[model samples]
Target: MKKHLILLLLWAVVGVSARAQKPATVTIPKNKYGLQVVSSTALYQQLVEQNPDQELVELATYIPGLVLDIKYATPDNLVKEPVYTMATAYARKPVADALKKIQEELKPLGLGLKIYDGYRPYHVTELFFKKVKKKAYVANPKNGSRHNRGCAMDLTLITLKDGKELEMPTPYDATVKQSHPDYPHVSEQVKKNRALLINTMQRHGFTVFHNEWWHYDFNEWPKYPLMDIRFEDLKAMKN
Candidate 1:
């Protein structure tokens, strides 16, 4: 009788341990546009377990001295209202790593990056499509933006000493023709500043968006899945 009881207890302990070791299962749901977005924390964790590079890293913490000026977190964006709950930026592990190198390269030149946006949630891309006047400026929800993949960055150079913005062709988020990276009407100084930003980013495996001087897409963007996980949730996971 004593041997039977001990055996039963051991079996129970083994079963409980097996269950505890199993990862939580999560389902990724498709949106109205029939796109499967990784929205839940569990789903994101699963992906990270499979590929550590899939993790969304906070840029400010990952890249030392990285500045963030997330317009959508305030009322200054094209939406004219706050889209993000927090004024923070995130990108895939590799993207953040690349930006860290770019920051190091720029530091010696008395310049550094000021991020306007990064890792936009999928829902915000849908919202921008509905609100923005120019369709060209916003990504269609049917096909998610590179930003949703945590592989795109909207940024520009700033003077590291005083943190003053370096002059570009147009202000961030501008939809005018002058916003195009190759626009020729800008002053000589603005041209030089824009070229510096483009060249530096290009050297670091980023391609500048043709229509937006401040936007750059990581070459490996297509490898990352579209994500809609909120900034608050991502922050919680980090803790």
Candidate 2:
């Protein structure tokens, strides 16, 4: 009986040590609003393995000559503080492909898309809801913004030669009425510039947001899941 007990104790110790040697899997729980955000990089990788379209491609690297002005990464945004550690832009595979095509189309016109923001983390959206006063401009945390899904892009038109921004109705992230896509109080030059942006994005797979002239949502935004992955983690991901 003593020998049997000793062997059983050794077996238990071996089992415990084996379990301890294995890495623990991280699991993300639903947020207070009950939204199942993809916060785990492992889970995101698994999804990408299942569907190549689920991969979030870095926009700057994927799109040639793509100009990025990530406002959320600086203190210049509506939040008045830096929300992201890196000034980077990323989007789903399909969204990147569409943007690439759009860049190609705009080359002939001496205009290019300048991205202000893209692929916003879910936590940043929550922060924006708290800091932003205009409910119309900021997305509610309850329903997660399309930006959190890597499907929405905040951008404007820029000259390819001088890299200067085109005249638009309002500045990026403006909450004023003039920011509306159909706001008619602006000058003809602003109107023409806004129309050019809206029309070009519409010709592709993007639809302009009704309230924001610089914001565009991919037609397939519904397919991607809301993601809370940080930009640094995405950059660290192996190609």
Q: Judging by lDDT against the true structure, name the best candidate.
A: 1
Instruction: Give the per-residue lDDT of model 1 (tens digit) for 1-239.
Output: 99999999999999999999987655568888888899989889999997899999999988988899999989998989999989999999999999999999999999999999999999999999999989999999999999999999999999999999999988999999999999999899999999999999999999999899999999999888899999999999878
Provide the clashing-pair count of each candidate structure: 0, 0
As a TM-score, model 1 comes out at: 0.88
How many backbone clashes can be found in candidate 2?
A: 0
lDDT of 2 by residue, 52-146 (tens): 99899899988899999998889999989999999989999999999999999999999898999989999998999999988899899999999
Error of 1 at 51 (Å): 0.5
Clashing pairs in 2: none
